[model samples]
Target: MITLIRVDDRLIHGQCIVRVLADFKIEKIVIVDDFTASNPVLKNVFLLATPPQAKSVIFSVEETKPNLLQFIENNENVLLLMRSPTVALELFKSHPQLKMELNIGPISYRPDTIKVTSYTYLSTEEIEAVNEIAERRVRVYFNQTIDQKIIEWNEVKNLLRSG
Candidate 1:
């Protein structure tokens, strides 16, 4: 089963290996990002960054639909990682049966983005995407690491005054 479905900008990094891996007791990290999956170097980099405790695999958006259930069946503990809410929204919309929570983590500041949290910055499009995901009954929350308290999307939406 999917232990945690996380939207982390930096897919597999120091924070992930140091905190998330242990905190979540993740056994397999399924990265659902088209760009990173298509790029060999970036895929290898993320794979290398993944700690020995958890195995990491990359898959594109389309690939997820057919393979996600299979991935979950095979892995004891799964951490579904996506780079953005866009991808997570796609997965949530496509795979409705797979009930899971979405944890937004460390989305970097971008040109057309507003700061949602210190670690999370989102563009107008991303904000809407997340709202849509929450509307579908998927509980979404924001936090950099497990050590911090989670901020629910409801609070975030109220803060944004746009949800």
Candidate 2:
């Protein structure tokens, strides 16, 4: 069972190791990213960042479809981390049975990307990807810290569509 599902540009960072995982008591972290999975150096960097007790596994988008079910079955309290909203949308497409609200975390600003909030940014493609996911009824919210108010995906989507 996936205890937490987060879409953060920085897959495994200080916030993730020190706060997110600790807050949720996540024992296993499954990072679904094509680039990180294929690159050894990046994969090791993430591994090093993870807490000693918390196991981290990086899988390409293609591999995740086949492996996600097994991973979820093995660990009841797993934190599912994706590099971007697009990746999370892809994962949801492949594994629709995994019903969990998506947490829109830090999506760093990039060229031509619209800043949804201080912590969230979206390129045209990223916005479209998120819109598709939201259309599927996957609740997306922007909440960096536990106390922050949840910003609904529909609100953001409408803003993007209108602007």
Candidate 3:
């Protein structure tokens, strides 16, 4: 019973804690980020940011599949968060049985990355991965918050190709 699968570089932040929690009755926050999960200090920071009523845990990308199986078995209402489109692509590849939509938000500008929109950014590799995900019949859209306008990948696909 996963409610949402979100990709935000800033995994758990003030805005996300406020916006996502308000829109979805998220019972559990599962963060899948290798670095964040392995770092004691950063891991505690993300966990501490979780709402009191909602349970939270962090796992490496390699560990999410088995955990997701249990979450499904228990019918847990989950909000799965991860860092990048690459991670999302990996998840889709690893768990091909999953039928989930992807919502992307706030990938900060970095070297070799193209600014797709105000909040969304992508490298050439990332853009290709995104297209690959969409080709797999997954609905992939970009929205900063639940209330904001959702920009479908198709809307930007051609624009990116011309450039």
**Each prediction's Cα lDDT score?**
0.88, 0.85, 0.86
Candidate 1 on 1-163: residue-level lDDT in tens? 7888999888888888898889989999999999998999999898888888888889899987899887656647899999899999998887886756889999999899999988999999999999999999889999888779889998879879854
Give the CA lDDT, 0 to 100, for residue 126 in model 1. Answer: 96
Candidate 3 residue pairs in backbone clash? none
Candidate No. with top lDDT: 1
Off by over 4 Å in 2: none
Give me the displacement of residue 124 in model 1, in angstroms: 0.8
lDDT of 3 by residue, 70-104 (tens): 76556767888898888889988888766569998
Worst-scoring 10-residue span by lDDT in model 3: 67-76
Candidate 1: where are CA atoms >4 Å away?
Answer: none
Error of 3 at 31 (Å): 0.4
Q: How close to the true structure is residue 88 of candidate 1, measured as C-alpha lDDT?
A: 91
What TM-score would you give candidate 3 relative to the actual structure?
Answer: 0.95
Sort every candidate by lDDT, greatest first: 1, 3, 2
Q: Select the stronger candidate by TM-score from 1 and 2.
A: 1
Off by over 4 Å in 3: none
